[model samples]
Target: MAASGKKNNILKVLLIIVLIIGLVAAWLGYQAFMSPSIATSEDYFYVHTDEPYESVIKRIEDEGIVKNPTYFKYVAKSMDLQNGIKPGRYKLSKDLSNRRFIGNLRGGYQEAVPFRFQNLRLKENFAGALGKSFEADSTTFLNILNNETIAEKYGFNKDNFFSMFIPNTYEIYWNTKPEEIIDRFASEYKKFWNADRKAKAAALDMTPEQVSVLASIVKGEALHVDEMPEIAGLYINRLKRGMLLQADPTVIFANNDFTIRRVLNRHLTIDNPYNTYRYKGLPPGPIMMPSIASIDAVLNYNHHDYIYMCAKDDFSGYHNFAKTVAEHQINARKFQQALDARNIKK
Candidate 1:
């Protein structure tokens, strides 16, 4: 009976040891799987294309995404995250755990980047903006834009291809390829020029691209949205009369000097197709990306007889429209006097 009691006491000690081990194991499991892992300053974490797992781990540490990476690394290895690291922009909340973070990476769950672009003047500007927002560099985007074959595939030439990208906030993956981005723009361009818009373009005896070209000039000329329709009307009148557009914006574009606040006579004499003063009709392509409002203004231009325009002397960013060259000259003289008064001699 004493021997039996000793065995019972030994069993109790062993059971206590087992219970302690179980508790420690549970605590470790909870730490490894459920503890808050991410403590990032940035709301999103970017894993670049072809970036190695080691680089990503280092970035997480360097970027202060976590206080301790050891447990995260352990979870990642258990989940096989290193072998299957998906390139993407991932949203990291403060509540994300090691297991949850590794699970997202392993499952290829990534957030889409909301990319917004506007007021871009040149293809270089567009490429630079895209490069900053995506994994593809500026050179990659520029090369695709300059490729004549790709341009033709999208039903545009190199000159007019700039008009294809409509300015708006778009959702795209950070790892999206340049070709894929171009394809998305093509899809958006088609969607923007619907039946109603196409009919409006047709009524004006212009293609959608041509309308965008005129819209770009109007966008450059008018800062006020209300003035766009009237400015578009003035240019349309000049087009109807077979008169040279003589738009100062075109001369500025041809010179490639955005700093030119005042267009000089020499600027008009620039031997370039983009110089509307030298060439009749619209320029070969859009000088800049036209806003949607600017494009719509062209399609819904005011019906008027005004064929000329000069910036108002008040410097209020409005233009004075005229039916005759004499009236336009008067407006121009007043604006010139105002510019002289301000010492704007450029």
Candidate 2:
């Protein structure tokens, strides 16, 4: 009876040992199959400009950069990277563990390049510069601004193509679509337009577009912010009296070249609708992109009876105002004398 009891005890101990070994083997197998491998593989991965999150996962899977697309999607969701993935060209490899890769993507590993719009004149050049910075299609982007249908929808005429846009520095994700970027800028512009500006535009008997046109001229003419209000008033007075604006900027625009070192009789005769000297009322559109200061100047213009202005030779950025041609000619001669003395011709 003692021997049989001992045999039963040994059999139980052996069974328990086998069961423990089996459990451990199963656990090891599960871990090996579920975990990402750290073995390096030759694969290229790309994240297109403005590509959605789901598309990014598919690209990762398709390029063999990740072992499983569904698993990556799950990880990305848990990390809250669904809508936060930046657009750019990314090079990835399978050597990275799943956790490390997810962390990298969520951390925003791509670089941001800034596109600045300062002292720029042409709309096409602006589009091209932005496109090049973002690796987008420059031609396609510029074409949108040039398109008659699109321009009309945006409340733009041929003359106002460049004027409608405000200049500022923008940080755009690489590969963003050109149209998407334009829409983004339009949305940003709304912050500059408040109720007060809208009411002021209404008081001037002008649309926001027309106000922008005047503001652009103000931007090009004024040498300082302090000069804008009075310059704006001078133009408004001329408009009210049915007198020619006779702005030198208009003549420069009509000439289709900005290097107007001197304005002459020939420049006045080169003639397009933009020449306020030849045609009455405001030019067809603005001559340059206006700053907020210039826009505000036109909106809340000072109520003055002055109709003419000439730049002061003192370089104080202030203009001499006159109400008659004779007074204006005297101021003009003063400016001319100063210019001639400085070897500047007009």
Top candidate when judged by lDDT against the true structure: 1
Task: Give model 1's TM-score versus the native structure.
Answer: 0.96
Per-residue CA lDDT of candidate 1, range 1-346, in tens? 9999999999999999999999999988788889887877688888888898899998887788876777777777888887988888888998899888888887779988789998889999999999998989999999998888999998999999999999999999989988999999999999999999999999999999999999999999998999999999989999999999998888999999999998888788889999998899999999999989999999999999999889999999999988988998999999999999999998
Top-TM-score structure, candidate number:
1
Q: Which pairs clash inside model 2?
A: none
Worst 10 residues of 1 by lDDT: 66-75
Q: Would you list the C-alpha lDDT of every candidate in the order shown?
A: 0.91, 0.75
On a 0 to 100 scale, what is the lDDT of residue 31 in model 1?
Answer: 88
User: Candidate 1 at 264: error in angstroms?
Assistant: 1.4
